[model samples]
Target: MDVTTIIGLFVGILSLVVGFLIEGGTLGSLLQETAAIIVFGGTIGAVIISFPLKTLKKVPFIIKYAFTASSSHSMTTVENMVELSNVSRRQGLLALETQQDMYEDDPFLSEGIRMIVDGVEGETIKDILNREIELYERRMLSIGKVFETAGGFAPTMGIIGTVMGLVHVLGSLDNPSALGPAIAVAFIATLYGVASANVIYLPIFNKIKARLDDDLMIKELQAEGLISIQYGENSTLLRNKLMAFIDDEVKSESEQVEDVNVNA
Candidate 1:
């Protein structure tokens, strides 16, 4: 599990509760079953209506992965790519088949190696890998859109719930003393709607987008590295080229060390 996602979500919820308490609000006042059902149920119904069942079926997996830790293994990938480049340069392209097991966990790298081992043209390899990246991103973005749709509908559902509550308040005007509390209870649906949209749904959507970018960068790097190996590029040159994909700070420090070695 990704602890940051858990921590961020916890902190967000706690902030709301703490802020409410600071404002002299009672916790019991926030626990309205009617408001919850109205806001959450309506929001869910809206999302279901907006998307197909096949798309909705992926929500559980999408939500699970949003909280899951994803590893880029960028440096390890570069190292393996460099090693494969050297192996191919010295022995032959067929030698990469023996090293394929090392990349079994990374389907992108493993598949790229397999294609090259089978003598797939470098251009063809690049095209196939790029196409896979495009399709994968499309699917992930579609899943992220589910949360986006929910976030968009939640506020409106809240307003609907609040209005329904207010209509009830209007019917109970005989008990004027209860008006203030009743109005407050009616607004709780609005709170649930707004809070869930901003704190939960939208944030998860953005998290999935951010993860997509990270995963794409790693995949692109693998694609480039694999293509270079297929073309029998020099291992040193390929390493230098791939190192550019690392973070700027790491790349700068590595360059400085290289300069010192050259001067020595």
Candidate 2:
């Protein structure tokens, strides 16, 4: 689980509630069942109309992905590539076929290696893997779009709810004493809409996109590694080449400081 995501959600809710309390707002004033029903129900109806049923089925997975921290495999991928390079250099490309089991968990890596062992051309390997990556990206992004769609529709739904509430308020104008409370209840729809959009839907969409980018980078790294292995690149040189895929922040801070000291 992602602790930061949990912490951020908690902080956002706590701040809102505490700030409201400080401003002399009651919790009861915020708890309007009618407003919630209108905003959320309308938003859901909009989302359902916007996306297909198949795509909507993945909401649970999308939410789980947003809350979960993705594991970094850059270093492991680099090391594995270097190992494969060494094996191919010593025993020829055909030897990699026997080692396919080692990468079974990663079909992308395994398939690339299999193609290499099958004597696929370097350009063809790159083309096939790149196309696969593109398709994977498109598919994942379409799923994340559910959140994006919801975020967009929520505010509009809130406004609609507020308008509907105001219409009712106008209808009951003779009850002057009830006007302020009616207006307050009507505006709760707007609050729910805006808050849910900002704090939940939109953030989850961005988080899913961030995770997707990470997964794509790993796939690209593996593809590069498999191609390098097929071409009989030196393990040391391949390792250095693959190291470029790792983020600078992920590299050791001590090593960078030591390099500066050595230069000094």
Local distance difference test, each candidate: 0.92, 0.88
Model 1's C-alpha root-mean-square deviation from the true structure amounts to 3.1
Model 2: residues with Cα > 4 Å off, grouped in runs: 253-264
The most accurate candidate by TM-score is 1
Over 1-264, each residue of candidate 1 has an lDDT whose tens digit, in order, gives 888888999999999999999999999999999999999999999999999999999999999889988876567677778888989999999999999998798888899999999999999999999999999999999988999999999999999999999999999999999999999999999999999999999999999998888888889888999999888889999988998889988667766878999999
Model 2: lDDT equals 0.88
Q: Which stretches of candidate 1 lie over 4 Å from their true place?
A: 250-264
RMSD to the true structure for each prediction, in A, is 3.1, 3.2
lDDT of 2 at 85: 88
Give lDDT: candidate 2, residue 42.
Answer: 91
Best by lDDT: 1
